[model samples]
Target chain A: MSWLLTLLAPILGGFLYGIERKLTARMQSRKGPPILQPFFDLFKLADKRPMVVHSYHAFMGIIHFVAAWVALSVLFFGGDLLVAIFFHLLSTSLLIVAGYSVKSTYSRLGATRELIAIAALEPILILTAISFYLHTGSFEVSKILTAPTSIFTSVLGFLALLIALPGLLKKSPFDAAEAHQEIVGGVEIEFSGFFYDTVYAAKWLDMLFVFTLVFLFGGSSFVVGGALAVFAFFVVLLADNSTARVRYCDMVRLLYSLAFVLAGANIILGVVL
Target chain B: MKKTIHIPIGSQHISLLEPVRFSFECENETIIKVEADVGYVHRGVELACTTKFKFKQVGYVVARVCGLCAIVHSTCYTLGIEELMGIEVPKRASYLRLIANELDRIHSHLLCLSHTAENAGYEALFMRIMKDRELVMEVQEAMTGNRIQFDYVSIGGVNKDMNSELEGVIRNKLGLLHQKVAEIKELFDNNWSLSLKYKNVGVITKEMAYRSSLLGPIARASGVNFDVRNDSDYLPYSELGFKSITMEGGDIHSRNMVRLFELFESIRLIETALDGMPEGEIAAKVRGTPEGESYMRVEAPRGECFYYLKASKGQYLDRVRIKTPTFGSVPGMIEALKGSNYADVPAIIASFDPCLSCTAR
Candidate 1:
């Protein structure tokens, strides 16, 4: 069952992305595209002839998607939280390299911002994992699930994760890395055809990956996990709608001063009491 | 040591409404040098006005210079010809012209505001403003025949007539639009994150605005206090109680606020004009052909739109020259972009509300 679910992560992520688009449009008072728009996009993208830039650039995109899938699989197979994080980081790193591999200025700029975003966000993910370890007495997801716990015990950590979700998902106010209006989808501008499909699928996978981290807050209870996931999803959607994209410097400053501080405080509290 | 990179926002870019190109020299996302190209959209409309169209038909021809400010173009052209031909425009026609011009300004401002929001990554706010803009659009369609390219102005007078029923429709829609725009104003004024993107991001100081000869909302935001309506007697704006809105911040936020306040002002002007409309003909008979040169300037939504016409009592005019707001404001736009982060480029450009169709006409 775990294997089946882990293999189906991309499909689940695709639907989640489609729902997010629909919800964003409805909030914007627009009759948005259908819920299956992402899938439709995927089909259309896959059908295009692959316009290969360079061998390394195209290879990196496929590897990036594979690495993201592996990261999700590692978590779903009841693996260590730290290893899952490592694979996730690797996926992003590959995409960043692919961005740098291109000569496109927008792609390079997007990569630079994406690197900055990762620097701003990776610390919180590690801290959240450490907070989990401190609470559960184990870094293993399988052990953490069976261990008796609820979201109430680590409310601060939960809040910290919730705050960082927008950055992770590249929503408004923190979406400088992928700001379509300015950099024209940033790193994704240089990608096209089947290679682009891999990158797009990887984005949905990244969404699933981050939400899975949010799901960890539920800890052994399916109801609490699902509810947290749904709530966190809406919170992210609202933040995306109501705010303008901040400058990259402001994004880093805010993530550090707010989400970073909360995550660090949660860790400190875990150690103290 | 400094490492500067070149980035180009081009003639076919996604964010641009018209074809324009900006080549920027950046040192790690801070623009240091800028080169702009605004001529890609030129359709030889000036030359066409002289060669392809007669003096009477030139008003409609110039209207095609820009769809957003079509009335302003036609009005400027017609007023110049009227001055040259010595035609007395009816008071009711002048009032009706004022209302159509103000309505055009309202819709254009709303579009700029919505685009500024979109460029800031606030898609929801963009959509909200666009939805509210439908109110002004409805009133505009009723006033003129079309929604966008409303060909209401002619060589002698306006083509549309104002009635009691139309007046009621305009009043009801503007009232609803006022409330919706107020909510939007509240959001823009108080939304902290939006302020971060808009406030002080694309600043053009008063000195810079003056030095660069900035016009319209961009100039008003910098406290230039130069509105063509206040300077000219072409549109009967004084009788309509016209007042130009200005802000001192001179940033994207200030420009947006100026536009919002101007929306309220435009609504008031339209309502007042409707109330005091004279009971006369909507248009006057076309008299003799235009002779000699006359210059006419009108306050377009973006800024002052100037038209120069020279006629020799012939069917075709001798020459026609158009100066649009966007052309005058480009220097100020470059100045604002010099030291700002590249991320703010779209928002800043949108705030200027560059109408390239007019610029490159």
Candidate 2:
């Protein structure tokens, strides 16, 4: 059961992304590819031999993919919440390094923006994790399920997850790094073939990682988790269709504003209730 | 000892949706110096023109320079050749050319403005402008038989004729478009933050703009009252009494405002030309090709796009030299970026509307 859940998290995340992309295309008034198109894209990319520009870029590629997978696997194991957050941060850090190693100005600027975005949202994420630990008296996901409380108050933590939602999808208004139509893939411009595929899957896995974090706030039930994950995916897709990308400076400013307001509200609620 | 800072902007570049490189030396946020290296465009059609084409074929070759502004390129080149050959285009042909060029201008300017707004973090404004641009594109496709690369202009005149029905459709659409453009203009003018981002940012002095030999809006923004249409009286432009709109401040805001105002000027030119519909043939057949060195200049979407052609006794031309408006403004742009903050780099670049393909070609 544990192994199945671990596999299912990434698979579900990847599947949702494929669906989201198709939905975005439809909203743009074009006939999009099949929902399984990303699977086919992954298969095609994997079949090609991975080419490296510098050996370190390839190393970052491996680290980014593996770290995200390991982070989500930690969630699946019902292990330490702090440990999963660290691994997720590790994956993002690796991506930043990869972006910096490229000679393109677009990639460098994008990496800089990604770093700023992380700075804006990481504090709120830590606060949400602490809120979970305070409510359940454990940092482990397996232990948090037994606490007696309705799903509504837990919605506070989910709102924190929602606040960081744009970062996870990397879609419009927050797509500072890989703005495909704008910067022509930004940090990932130099990435191609199998290495590109790894980064692509890692992106999907990162989405899964955050959605899994959202599901935890809802509870540990598989049915509720799956339903909430679907809900999160649709919300992100809607944003992608409706919004054009905001500049990195604007994105950071918005994130900070929302984080302080929502996270501060949650902190006050913890004091009163 | 002084350390020289080497920064590369693009080569597998993502920003600007095109490949262009800039190496700049900056002390803190102030740029000490800058150099533009633009050779990413690899289409060698001009060299191919020496063998695979005739004087008549030059229009098609010029149009291939860019997909988006193909009609502008073709019309400019054809107009230049026609002028050199002393062939007066029919009245209707000139009017049709003006209509096509102005419509192209609307789409091109809207596209640049939308991208500029997007880069500046103005999502709502960008979408609104882009939607308006789509209306112009739909009109273009309906009239020209293609969305882009209109191929409307030939050696002597235009290929397609605008009938009464097509004219009625375009006129009605233009009325709606004028209202939309007014709304967009109001939106930009009223936005305080947008003014802050643009006003006094990327300041290019009159002396600097002139020294760099800047043309079009970049030059006009600096208060240079020069337009190729006024200089040569090409097409229906001279007949319509086209206004050469300009501004004093040569900053990013002025550049944007000049373009914004020119959008209205273009519409006015089209409306006047369409109402005064001249009756005649759209094209004429050219027999002898005895052309010496002749040059022509026209205002492209960016600014003045120049084409110099030398024709031989036979079918192909001896040589074709192009000076895109973007290339002329490169020195001006680098000069403007001298002391602006690092955050304003993308916006400054967008303001110049540097079409790399045009520059590289």
Candidate 3:
């Protein structure tokens, strides 16, 4: 089952993204692209001529995808939560390195912004893992899955994760790193052909990883986990549609002051009660 | 040992609709110096107006200068010829012209708003505004017999007349568009994240607007109070009770609010013109060739669209000069960009609503 899920995560993530595109289109009063559009785009990208700035940049793309898949598999097999989180972080850092390795200004700018975003978001993710450890008294995902609802006691921690989701997903109000209008495609500006496909698939895997974190809070009920993930997905879509992209500085200020405080409070409560 | 880095945007960029280029000198993410090149779309339409086309056919030639404001170009050029020939357009023609002009304004403003939203990463709002803008485009096609390059304005008057069926279509679509505009205005006013992106970003003061001689919405957003529609008598704007809209902040949000308010005002003007339209001939008879020089200015969707015509009472004119609003506002745009974050470059450029074709022509 874990092997099957490991193989299926990217395909399923693409389908979810396709559905998101469709929903966004309907909300905007237009008939959106077909649901299989992401797959079509990926295949089209695969057929293009491969271009790279350097050997390391090309290698890093493959490494990033592999690391993301490893992170997903760890979650699927119910391995240690901290290990999966660290692998996820590794995947992102590899992509940032790829971005920085390119001499293009857009790529450098995008890499810097991504670094800042990771700085803002990584702490909350670590805190989320800590809260889970506090709840089940174990770092193992399998143990947490068998435990009763963590939401009842760790509601504040869940809220913090929910607030951080947009930044993690790089949706609007927090999508400053890839602001297509400002820096063009930013980190992805220098990528093309098969190299781009790897980066694109890695994005899908990352989305799956974050939503899975949301699912972890459901604790023994698949229905609650699925519901929470769906709810968060819709909220992110609504936000992406209605708001403008905030500056990177404002984004950091918001995550630290609000989301960090929520997670810190939740951790303090778990220690006390 | 310099800390500033140069970032080039455009010539070919995803955010830019036209092929204009800008080179920004940045320290960290803050822009320290800005340089703009706006000659990419120049097709020498001014030269074509005087050489390739006769005085009577120059109206259609000038209309090709910019697709977004095609009607304003034709109208301004035709009005200039009318002034030279002393041809008096009928009341009904003026009213029809007014309606077409405002409809053009509605669609242009909506396009600018949609573009600004898209640049801000609000893709849904961009699509929504574009979907609604189709309502006005349909009305325009019905009245002018074309969607984009409508040869609606001729030397003496308008080419097509609005019928009762077209009138009904215009009214129904305008009503729907009014409600949608209201919703969009509310969204712009209340959405917190949108406010964060727009409220203090790319600020241009009233003093800067004056020094730059900014016209249209960019100027109006900065409290400049200079709209060609209110300041000139080239059209029946005074008769139609036109009131120019202005805002205080001169930021992206202020510019958007100014556009929204002007949209409502345009709808009201169109409705009034339709209700009070008199029955008369659409076109007046043209006599001799334009003998003397005449200068005409009309309020285009962007700002003042100026045309200077010098005729020698012959088939061809000696000169035809066009000074577009975007050209006038480029300095103001550069002023707004200085000291702003590099991330806000696209948003600030969109807010100024720079029409490159208009400028380059």
C-alpha lDDT score of every prediction, in listed order: 0.91, 0.77, 0.91
Q: What's the distance in Å from true for residue B1, model 2?
A: 13
Candidate 1 docking band: high
Q: Of the candidates numbered 2 and 3, which has the greater DockQ value?
A: 3
Candidate 1 structure quality by residue, lDDT tens digits, A1-273: 779988898899999999899888889877888989999999999999888889999999999999999999988989999999999999999999999999999999999999999999999999999999998998898887877664776788889888889989999878999998989998888889999999999999999999988888888887788889999999999998889889899989988999999989898988998
TM-score of predicted chain B, candidate 1: 0.98
Report DockQ per prediction, comma-separated.
Answer: 0.87, 0.13, 0.81
By DockQ rank, best first, the candidates go 1, 3, 2
> Which scores better on DockQ, 1 or 3?
1
Instruction: Write model 3 residue lDDT over B1-361, tens digit each, in one string.
Output: 8688889998999999998999999999999999999999879888887789888888888888999999999999888888888899998888888888888999999999999989988888898899899999998888998998888888777888878988899999999999999999999999887888899889999999999888999889999999988888877889878898889999999999999999999999999999889998999988998878888999998999999989988999999999999999889889999999988889899998889989998
| Root mean square deviation (Cα) for candidate 1 | 1.1
Per-residue lDDT tens digits for candidate 3, residues A156-232, read 99899988988988888888888888887678888889999989999889999999999998999878888888898
Worst-scoring 10-residue span by lDDT in model 1 chain A: A145-154
- Candidate ordering by TM-score (highest first): 1, 3, 2
Query: Looking at candidate 1, what is the lDDT of residue A167?
Result: 89
Candidate 3 residue B245 Cα shift, in angstroms, is 1.6
lDDT of 2 by residue, A49-77 (tens): 77677989878988899999999898888
